[model samples]
Target: MRRTHPANMFVCECITQSLFRLMKRKPYNKITVTDLVQEAGVSRNSFYRNYQSTEEIIRQFLEEKTSKWWSEFIAYPDRYPHVISEMFYHFLDMKEEIDLLYRAGLSHLLMEHIVLCGRQSLTGELKGQLQRHQLMKQNVTEDDSYEICY
Candidate 1:
């Protein structure tokens, strides 16, 4: 039988849950993949297979949680402003993990991912709104400022 990806049920959950619990008690830097694996009763290979590094895990965890909120935000555009506010608050709440990942040399990657996600989401929403207003034309010239404004 083929072994399942550790991320599906065992290793990733263990690592993430352990990290979440430990993060409340101490700084992220103090925690290690070994600690997580030990706490979660897994092996180093399992951790490695699921995550190249601890920073990757941290980024994935943050992204996963944020994606849920993002989905909810998109579902209710009237609460979009509140969603943005909550997003910032969530960032603040994860400051320790963010700081740890940054210190571990993953700051640039994490920031890029965050910015890319935000830009993609915004662009998608704008395109949807334009289409909804019937303002999006199939044959728009690049020189047209009307399309640019939209």
Candidate 2:
């Protein structure tokens, strides 16, 4: 088994929270690793142990957030549409951090992951819609076609 680095684990959580907070306030590029470590209350060495650079930390954060959103959406399919809207609101809410990540050139990877997840979610929703449509078609009474068409 591989041993986990304690410094990395600590720094990771700190950076995640700090970035989350920062995203709520300002653009991402405006923030620095120095700021991150200071806000996280961790030493520079601790931050370095887990991440070679701030961009790496941001990338990891984006990946984790995207995965979390995906899990939540899957868990409650009935709320998927609302979840998507919430995700958009989240991005708008975090515009500052997102801008910083984009300036750092890490947004591409993050956006790609998000887009892939969105595609998967959309495909799943479409499939469900098609199945429901098929069921409704099969159960249609003669008068139902006129009602549906009208």
Candidate 3:
């Protein structure tokens, strides 16, 4: 949405880049809105205009990354030799942020996000493998779906 307004986008982008840099250097709780605005070269109101809180920013960042992974995977569904392996590597690249989330006690949610992305972005070959391995239940349900993805 911010991208629609070039000036607002600059504000949003500056805030995002600054926050990520700060996050790498400090715990999320330790960072403040003032710190964000200062580091982002924007006013406190500018930060609030874009995000309700730092956690919201982090969530948005993760959501954007997951969306990106899905986009890339869908664009080349048959490109990967092993779908799950590709998923593993994709998450592997986020190790630092994942570790930070783990330390902040949000790993479980992130794990579920990753798994959901994995299940949704499954390639046709992977689906066939799941069917061949009988991962799917006769009456498919969320638990059965988890089994297939897991």
Candidate 4:
């Protein structure tokens, strides 16, 4: 059955919290859907209704965080001067989640999300803006800038 929006969000939040909590105590690879559901106090069917895999959970979390960071990053008028530092600080704020990702051998998902966020920029504005701000003052192409990021 289809869940109401709020109910779905509640289930998602429960599962996410449970996953993070479990990650703190065990290897992510060792945690199964049964473990997650039990920890979340949610039904296995509820977990499956919102996500297909544990990786999807992490991916969704990363996407939400990076997307929010990008939005807030763009809102600052003096963003260019401190963009790099701000980016690092933003990630630092998510250190726990990042640590979990690293411990889980899922660090690649972080890079993937970064690339995805870059691609989502308006008409490559993210790359172009960074280049204009001397991010790649060495005359690197947009594609090359991405390589530098990677």
Instruction: Give candidate 1 regions above 4 Å deviation.
Output: 1-7, 19-36, 82-84, 102-110, 125-150
Using lDDT, rank the candidates from best to worst.
4, 3, 1, 2
Tens digits of per-residue lDDT for model 1, 73-123: 556544444434565776787677677666556578667666655554445
Cα lDDT for residue 77, candidate 1: 45
lDDT of 1 at 49: 70
Highest TM-score: give the candidate number. Answer: 4
Candidate lDDT values, in order: 0.62, 0.60, 0.69, 0.74
Instruction: Check candidate 4 and list the clashing pairs.
Output: none
Better of 1 and 3 by TM-score: 3
TM-score per prediction, in order, is 0.59, 0.50, 0.69, 0.78
The whole-model C-alpha lDDT of candidate 1 against the native structure comes to: 0.62
Locate the minimum summed-lDDT window of 10 residues in model 2. 141-150
Q: Clashing residue pairs, candidate 2?
A: 27-96, 28-96, 28-100, 29-100
Q: Whole-model lDDT for model 4 versus the true structure?
A: 0.74
Better of 1 and 4 by lDDT: 4
Of the two candidates 2 and 4, the one with more favorable lDDT, higher being better, is: 4
Order the candidates by TM-score, highest first.
4, 3, 1, 2
Candidate that would win on lDDT = 4
Taking every candidate in turn, the Cα RMSD to the unseen true structure, in Å, is 6.3, 9.5, 4.3, 3.5
Q: In model 1, what are the clashing residue pairs, if there are any?
A: none
Question: Between candidates 3 and 4, which one is better according to lDDT?
Answer: 4
